[model samples]
Target: SERIFENEKVTVDTIPLSHRVYTNGFLFREKPKELGLNVDAVKKYGIDISHYHNIKKGKDVLLDDGSLIPNSELTFPPQKVKSYAFCSDTAYEPGIIPFVSDADVMYHDATFLENEKHLAEKTGHSTAIEAAKIAKEAQVGQLILGHFSTRYTNTDQFLEEALTEFQNTSLARDGKVFEW
Candidate 1:
């Protein structure tokens, strides 16, 4: 799915202002030797995340570790960067704030309401309220909620729930442009 786009690529590091790196997971794992960069370089840029990979292991790796290996050096340009974090179907992980802090925009999957919180956790997805909580804690410029659960007939509830925590929140539409 990440490989679907090979256009307009940039780097992502632990800091909001560091020399960005390309999508290492799609680039490195597929053709590292072809690119003449070692797989280690991808790890250096905090690209090959294990949290989403090892979610079933019952380990809060992203929490204990901040996306990158400790003591690693990765510098990315702070300016001229648009960080898009597709936190697809994840539980409430507060530790991720630092890594995603100050993103120009963030798309968090809000698939349930507070009343259906149990379903959210069970499905490995976050409630609209939780998504707002993350956007607020991360201090992202804007929060876009999507991936609505099938049970939800109207998307207004998603916006309503998120607004309770983060004021700058909006429901994601099929085709839309959110200017910074």
Candidate 2:
């Protein structure tokens, strides 16, 4: 519900989630980086390293000869920015759509299957389909379902049901590691 960290490079924010107790999710977003310097262009222009800072900051350079060099010609675009969202120990909570919309990746709680919807509701947890619906509504790049109930003998249904709504959904396991 509030931003916890921020600088020129990135930001981290908390999102309130529907749970029996006080619960929150997190959203981590990387800011657009400075433009990359075209070393070949710099060398070709005979520009000194002293002007590197200003050029990267998007400033045009004025040569000693009074010739002007555009910043666009000195630097290329930056890398793509990325965002991540984490929601757990919570219910279907569609109210969080705005905060997580367009996230590159999202990890959501899916503690039950559709057959146990009543149990999940009572426990303030979400079913696999509900998590997938949230991911689809938010248009997130990927959905990671986790926090399963111990009673379930198999987790295939979770991935299966979630995939029906969001094709990029994946299951989270105890020792599993995810990148991007």
Candidate 3:
């Protein structure tokens, strides 16, 4: 249940999950860009604004004094793009493992405890353990368990359960801020 929308510069994937009816999760990613001109290097080389675009596109620039400034000297290496995946209100879906593999951060549904796994399955939700298993299998940098069931009074158990499989697992709460 995945649909992909892509162009020359970006790709957005919508993953539809099985809930009581149908729900979708999205993954957004940026395409790699050409080497960009280093501002300091541009200033050092006394390059004009007109040649800035050319240097960013990896083209050498010709100086007014009949000297050639190599593109390598004017531009910096491209930066690595970070990726994130959000699994919204899904069951223990192994099918999505490939799409979200090796993501920098992953947020998955953890709506119930292991004791209530039957209810979680019936409602098309996942327990903390299930979410952690998915994170482990995907090899994500960080695993965030969210969407806890309101029936639970203490949510610390969710984090504890998730930690059994993925040491990097964390429980998400309202107003909680996560930094990469």
Clash count for each candidate, listed in order shown: 10, 1, 0
Ranking by TM-score: 2, 3, 1
Q: RMSD, model 3, all Cα superposed?
A: 2.8
**Candidate 1: residue pairs that collide:** 11-20, 11-21, 12-21, 17-78, 18-75, 18-76, 18-77, 19-75, 19-76, 19-77
Rate residue 173 of model 2 by lDDT: 90
Worst 10 residues of 3 by lDDT: 1-10
Error of 2 at 104 (Å): 0.8
Candidate 3: regions farther than 4 A off: 1-11, 33-36, 64-68
Estimate the lDDT of model 1: 0.62
The TM-score leader among the candidates is: 2
lDDT of 3 by residue, 66-151 (tens): 99989999888877666778898999888888878888788999999999999999999999999999899999899989999899
lDDT of each: 0.62, 0.95, 0.86
Q: What is the descending lDDT order?
A: 2, 3, 1
- Residue range 94-149, candidate 2, lDDT tens digits: 99999999999999999999999999899999999999999999999999999999
Cα deviation of 25, candidate 3, in Å: 1.0
The regions of model 2 sitting more than 4 angstroms off are: none
